[model samples]
Target: MKLVQFWRNGRPALGLQTERGVVDAAAEATRLGVTVPEDMAAAIALPAGELERLLTPLLQDPQCFTGAPLAPVVTGTDRIFCIGLNYRQHAKECGLPIPPAPVLFNKFSNALAAHGDCVKLIPDYKKYDYEAELVSVIGKPARNVSEEDALDYVFGYTCGNDLSTRDLQFARGGQWVLSKTFDGFAPVGPCLVPAGELDPNHLDISSTVNGEVRQSSNTSDMIFPLAQIIADLSHHFTLMPGDLIFTGTPQGVMHGYPADQKSWLKPGDWVEVTIQGIGTLRTTFC
Candidate 1:
């Protein structure tokens, strides 16, 4: 089942993309007098098979969610972990060597933006870039998990755009956190596909700017695949339900272009990140 979060009144509400249409889970659950998760975080924490049991009935009378806008697929996540240079071709384009391990970084909740939301470009930064990536959403607590069992902890996958400002990223001897984590920097969604529905390590991921394709590659190109990344990260810290792991981007970023050919994103641009089976996440810049 494809899951989503959308705005209802002033708060975020749970939604499900079903065969009938987008079902406002919260509303349907209320109408049917059924207790269901209120949002994505709550839904992720539901015991194994619980979500299906609770939501399956609601799907029968799908009340197509319309008019109201979509929110980020996840909003209450505790951590947003990001991997850098995990793609071999992307690393080669940046002139960096393949890393011995996954390069990890993080973004805060404030950076989360929904599909179709307009992201304001920081005027001080001249090199805004787009990174289309696959995001893994954790379903349960995980620590010291082995690569063999890493995927078991994942709940689902979503499309993400790791928006970056190159100048701020490379300035001051590398302020990765500052370069990343800006408000609305991490726009992910459209819908979250349950892990069992798709293979996490073998998806087509790509990015486009104002309708022009910029990056095109598959998750198979990732140097540190999802399993290894989860296992490696779990060894260091506990992965909680709703925690997001941005698996990294493929080749064809503005920073990878030769000096004269570089074209940074500007105001009034539309950027999109698409992952196979997971749908597209579109962001507008202003």
Candidate 2:
């Protein structure tokens, strides 16, 4: 199922993507005299049967559709873990060796930005780059999960952009969080797809800047596959529902370019990240 979170009456409301448009789940539930979870996080936290029960009505409805005014795929998530240099070509582009383990990093809740939102350029920095990634949304609590079972804990997937400032990221004492966690830095969504519905292993993912293709690659290029990332992460701490994991980006980032060829994101530049199955996530830097 493709689920979306969007604004209605100025508050976040749940949606289901369909042929006509987005099915406003909350609105349909109200009309059907049925009660369902109010938001994505709550729906994800529900038991499997209950979650299915709640979605059945919306999934079968012939109406209740509206144009998308989307919100972040998962709002108020507990943790937003990110992996660095997980693509062999990206690692080579950065001139770094393949790591012995998954290189984990993080972005805070403040960084969460929705599809179609504006990503404001940090005036203090000159080099802002975009990393198009596939995000895993945890469905249940998991601890020390095995690689075979890691995917079972996933609720779904969302397209993500790991926006970063190169100066603070590389030249300033290796402060990744400082460089990546600015307000509206982590832009994700359009909609989230159930884990069972899509193959994370081989999706085509790419990014464009001002209508020009900048990064193009497939998920098959990932150094540490999705399951391994989940397994490794669970070994260290509990993975909670609503937690997000940005699996990593492939080659062709601005940072990988030579000095003269580098073209960082600037104000008025429209950026879009597209992943197969999941739609495009568009952001305008302002």
**lDDT (CA) per prediction:** 0.91, 0.91
**Candidate 1, 1-286: lDDT as tens digits:** 8898889887888898765657888778878888999888888888888888998898776664555799999987659999999999999999998999999999999999998899999788889999999999999999999999999999999999999999999999999988989899999998998888999878999888989999999999999999999999999999998899999999999999999999999999899888899888999999
lDDT of 2: 0.91
TM match of model 1 to true structure: 0.96
Clashes of each: 0, 0
Q: Give the RMSD in angstroms, all C-alphas superposed, for model 2.
A: 1.4
In candidate 1 the C-alpha lDDT for residue 146 amounts to 98
Error of 2 at 235 (Å): 0.6
**Candidate 1 colliding pairs:** none
Give the lowest summed-lDDT range of ten residues in model 2.
59-68
lDDT of 2 by residue, 146-248 (tens): 9999999999999999999998888757889889999999999978998888989999999999999998999999999999999999999999999999999
